[model samples]
Target: MNKRSPLDRHKQIRARLARRLFVVRGWLVLETVWRAAWPVGAMIGAYFALALLGIWEQAPAFVHLAVFGLVLLGGAGILWHRLRRAIWPGDADARRRLEESGGARHRPIDAVFDAPAMAAGASVLWRRHRDHMAETAQDLPVKAPRLSLVYEDPRALRAIVLLALFIGALYAGPDAGRRLFQALQPPFGDAPRTVVLDAWLTPPDYTGKSPIVLHGPITANKAHDEAAAPLSAPVGSMLVVRLNGGRQAPVLLAGEDDIPFDTVGTVDHRLEFALSDPDLSVLEIRQGGRSRALWPLALSPINRRASALSEPPLKVVGKPCG
Candidate 1:
């Protein structure tokens, strides 16, 4: 077996050390970035959570502007404060760290690249010392980067923010993404106009049945395609309709008649009618001459049956009894 020359041995040692230095430098940069930007990440997560929960929509325009500005300023301030004193690891710094990471006391990595003095160049002891340092540098160990920010955030606020974001996302359903985008829009922009309609069927007092909700805040879908099931109500039940936030008053279409809603307030309209006609099969609500809702009506006739004595109270003529 041929042995490696001193020059080849030096090259091998330098190559191994160079690779370790590269890795350590990368890890140092990643650690610095994490420490500087984690706070911003946490803030963004909390903001998104609120948006998903629809808190932004309920807040006023001024509140929206204030919150948006606060997030930007706070994020910038955090990044600047954390990065101002950050010292990026250079090649030399990485090399030093790599050597110290292995708990070496002899400073072997430094000695391998150092040139011997003129007086020490001829000494056999110096050559042996250099050989030992080169051998030690061959198997240097690099530790994983210190990326955790627990020391900076002793309260673990990031975890809490992540939890809130997760819960809000789940509660928001498939509309969470759209809501998030909406939350980012300018507060002064023209918002979409929505009309609210509430309709219910209330049975007469003698029927003793609870009112049935035909349309309400939760079931109001402008794009719903599936036809609503026919509603079965006792005869004489009152059909109450309340429309709010519409540009025009809503009208009730029963058979061929066009019944208009009574104006209650500037934007509120109400309609109340008895479901007495058995021939009325369908009811439709219209606004601006466009059908908003349709409900098939099935009126159930009131049950009225009289009880009669079956056998004339079981004549006891048998025994005037003992």
Candidate 2:
């Protein structure tokens, strides 16, 4: 077997120590970043969750501004506090830490860079000491850095915030991100209350048909663009309109007449009428003097002849009439 020369052995030992030092340095940086940024991340997540759940939209403009300011200030303060106490490990510090973790009793890593004294006998001693240190460092242990923020959040509030964000995202559907941005904007006047408009056609009990929804609970701004399909219901069916949480009562415009909705509550309105007008070809719902939704009505006359034909023919049971 070819034995390594003293110079080669020295190079190998130094290289190994350098790699350990690099790892320690990286972990130190990572720890510092985590400690400083975790609180800020948690704050941001909680804010986003509220936005996604539409809590901000329901609040006044002042409340939105207040929340924004609080988040900004809290984040800044947390970062400043954590960063002020953060210690950025230098090369020497990294080397010391690595040696300590490896359970080195003597300062082996320091000896690697120590210079020999000028005295003649000191050179031999220094060389022997470095060799011993190299031997001890051969099986050095490197432990992973402590990156958990459990101590900072003892009550596990961060986990709750994460859960809220997930739930809110699902509840908000595809418009989750859009709702967040909308919540950030402080409205000029009082925040617009969410309006729910539900309108459907209920066929007569004799017709044996389920109620057909003409418009689901859509917001006021999108009602016109998101109108449901044209309504085709049998004549004598009842058209029911329910408007909830709107500032003004809703109006039903069928043909030329404008029928006002009956008050149901402080902000609830309901209208129900029989669809007997065969000439009526369209229906419209108006709120605050603006058309919210329009549906083309196609009323089909009941077919009595078809109903009769669907029944079994009268049975002629009389055996061979006389």
Candidate 3:
């Protein structure tokens, strides 16, 4: 045999390496497809489940169905081609002969040896490729797509919903407003408003008796006379008024002896009666027994004035809140 140059030996090594690399690349592509395809298949399965469960409104069900169909068809076609070669030795031979000029060039045992050797050489290349890929991945940075104000945030959606509600209410106007208010019931039945306090009011400077005053317009008919004595604290009364000023005031009526109130700890705003007389007025009040000076005792009708003029301007109400 003729002496071979070092450069020729190197070229031979490179040619063998290139052939092995081609095989390795085919395997890598196959593995990559297999790995990627499963997740897509899983995603498709999940989307199909969501569609069946009736939760596909968020993302169109048909899109997922179509993707699944296309991927299945593509994968099936690729698998069928690979299986055709694997299944029939004659088919593989014919294809190999057609590609390589009419002769069956290699022996079966030669292929077995070459296959293992190619795999071993490819393993080295695969390790290098993996290292290269890791280095490449380190060099790159991941980035997310930018979204404008209304596209991606829940707050924006909430704002839109609120705006829609306000517009709807504005269109429906007063009747809707009244219905909305009427629909809401107070925490307690319309009980006469009463407040509980930690202490009672101070006695007037001159008189030793603790004083209490009733404010608000007194109805001419419901003057709260002695005949209507022992007035029951009716339901639906709200403790609308509060008194923090004036330490001392005139007590409405004085009992002969030191009453349960005087003997007990400071009496908060509550019903009181003289020990001698059981028949007495039961006035509802704030913590210090002060009345709401703002509104009258009874609501007045606005027959003389228009409804719009009688009431304040309507306002948009938000989602039902307590």
Top TM-score model: 2
Backbone clashes in candidate 2 total 0
The reply for model 3, stretches above 4 Å from the true place, is 1-118, 138-157, 160-200, 207-281, 285-322
Candidate 3 TM-score, C-alpha based: 0.20
- What is the C-alpha local distance difference test score of candidate 1? 0.76
TM-score of each: 0.56, 0.58, 0.20
**Tens digits of per-residue lDDT for model 3 on 224-293?**
3323423222122222223221112212232233221221211112234322233322333221243322
Sorted on TM-score, highest at the top, how do the candidates line up?
2, 1, 3
> Order the candidates by lDDT, highest first — what do you get?
2, 1, 3
Instruction: Report, for every candidate in turn, its global Cα lDDT versus the true structure.
Output: 0.76, 0.77, 0.34
lDDT of 1 by residue, 27-124 (tens): 88888888888989998889889887767755766787688888889899989988987777787777778888887767887778777675744767
How far out, in Å, is residue 181 in model 3? 17
Q: Tell me how far the alpha carbon of residue 148 in candidate 2 is from the true structure, in angstroms, after superposition.
A: 4.8
Better of 1 and 2 by TM-score: 2
lDDT of 2 by residue, 84-134 (tens): 888877998787778788888778887875665668767777788788888
Any idea what lDDT model 2 has? 0.77
